[model samples]
Target: MSDVSNSSRTTRKPKGEGHSRRGEILTAAERIFVEHGYEGATIRKIADEVGLSSTALYMHFPDKGAILQEICRDAFSRLIAANAAVADEDAPPVRRLRRMIDGYVDFGFAHPNAYRLIYLTRPVEAREGAQDMARELGGGLFTTLEATVADAVTAGDLKGDPSVLAQAIWATAHGVVSLMITKPYFPWADRQTLVDTMLDAMFAGLPRP
Candidate 1:
């Protein structure tokens, strides 16, 4: 009985060690994937980076595509959560829009690597699928803006299609934030000036009596 109990403990040790090693490999894969991108990243390199055999890395993730999907899904879920957090039904449309823009910019800055991978880098087929996900995510942000626009329309602060107005606001903000990320070293004369200018342009184009 004593010999059998000792043998069982030894048998379980390798299994527990394998699980921990797999977790370490996955964490290393995420770091490599972020630096090199999905296509450029290799299983062998990830294994080497993690101090594991290539076969061991494969044991955790079947292939590079599986790792890519995992990263994309994880990053996107975080982005969706960030947007959802700032969406306030009770806030006025303009205020809600402001808060959404702030949240988006902060999220993009905070997760630059993930943001670039999810939003900036993609092949044509992947791009289309990502665009679809972006639209769905946008829908969450747009719902609040649309409702706010409806309120604005009722209050006579806006006019015309609320849908169009919502898209227009999204475009304006996206342009500014995307540019900021894509051209980090851009010699814009004044960053704050540009932001203020864009806001002014947005308000100017808004419905007026």
Candidate 2:
């Protein structure tokens, strides 16, 4: 009985331990990937970051690409959730759009490593799963922007081709976030000041009906 109990105890994992370890791996991987580009961040390095053997790390993730995919997937899910809140709000299209922009910027700032990985890194064609994630998440986000723009145009709150307007707005938001992440050393206005200035400029250029 004692032998059997010890074996059972050794084999059984404490509840949530696996999930906690995975989170730690992801956190360490993100820091490594950000500090060293994807190519430089090998599985061994990531394993070392988390104080695990490479073989043990492989038990959790098949390869570095899987880790990247998981990171992107999680980040995109959070972004979608944040945007969904604004989109679902019972507010004017213009208001919703502004809130979405704020949320997008906030997400970038909140998850700088994930943001850089998703946006700054070149697409990894080898990772089909990651590519699929990018397509699905990116497409959904863009569609929401387009639909919001269409609604605004329909309501006579703004005037422009919905597709073009949505693309422009996305590009502008991307630019703002990318610059803020990459050029932190540059002397710039306060974050909210920059966001407000950009939104005001964009709204002014976009014709109102």
Candidate 3:
């Protein structure tokens, strides 16, 4: 519940448990990446935050880049899986699209730290790391989204290039996530109400088929 972009020490987990230790490392690395950015987020920094030594961290991950990639892969993989489930629903494509969008926004709110680490880091190194991710999970995330958009177009419920629509829709959702996360001080409407209003307004703007 505290800020993920802070170097807060977590309670140290036991070393022998690989899964839990990996999770702790990831949780700590998320905070380190945001607090220090990619170039600054050293293995030592992450290890210290998670209560591990650099050598112990290496046993779990090769380097900070690997750590970053794993974090991004998990986040994007979960999102894509959630969207895939939405895609399978017997609802209308446009309505199913709304469900997918809802899942995306819910992720931002539920795991703001992971979201920020994936999308909002500012350093050049961080951006490059994100770009590299595009070849893997990041690319898959967009491809999945584009496929959903294309389905909507094919269903005769929306009119637009699938790629463009997908990008625009994603950018709009990202805007909501980034703004809400970065500008928590701003006076804003209720969270769900604002999200619903924004989504409704966006869906209304789509050219009807």
TM-score of each: 0.66, 0.88, 0.90
lDDT of 3 by residue, 4-71 (tens): 43446666676468888888888888877777678788999888887778998899998888888788
Candidate 3 stretches greater than 4 Å from native: 1-15
User: Clashing residue pairs in candidate 3, if any?
Assistant: none
lDDT tens readout by residue for model 2, 34-123: 777778889887776666778977888998889988888888888888888888899999999988888888888888878877777766
Where model 2 places Cα greater than 4 Å from the true spot, the runs are 1-16, 124-130
How does candidate 3 score on lDDT?
Answer: 0.83
- What are the per-residue Cα lDDT tens digits for candidate 1 across 1-209? 00111122111125558866655555555556556766667888767765667786677788766665555566667656765665645766566666666666666656555565556666652452445555565466567667666767776777878888878877787678678867879886576677768877787788754
Candidate 1 TM-score to native: 0.66
Best by TM-score: 3
Query: What lDDT score goes with residue 109 in model 3?
Result: 90
- Model 1 segments beyond 4 Å from truth? 1-37, 50-52, 125-132, 135-148, 188-197
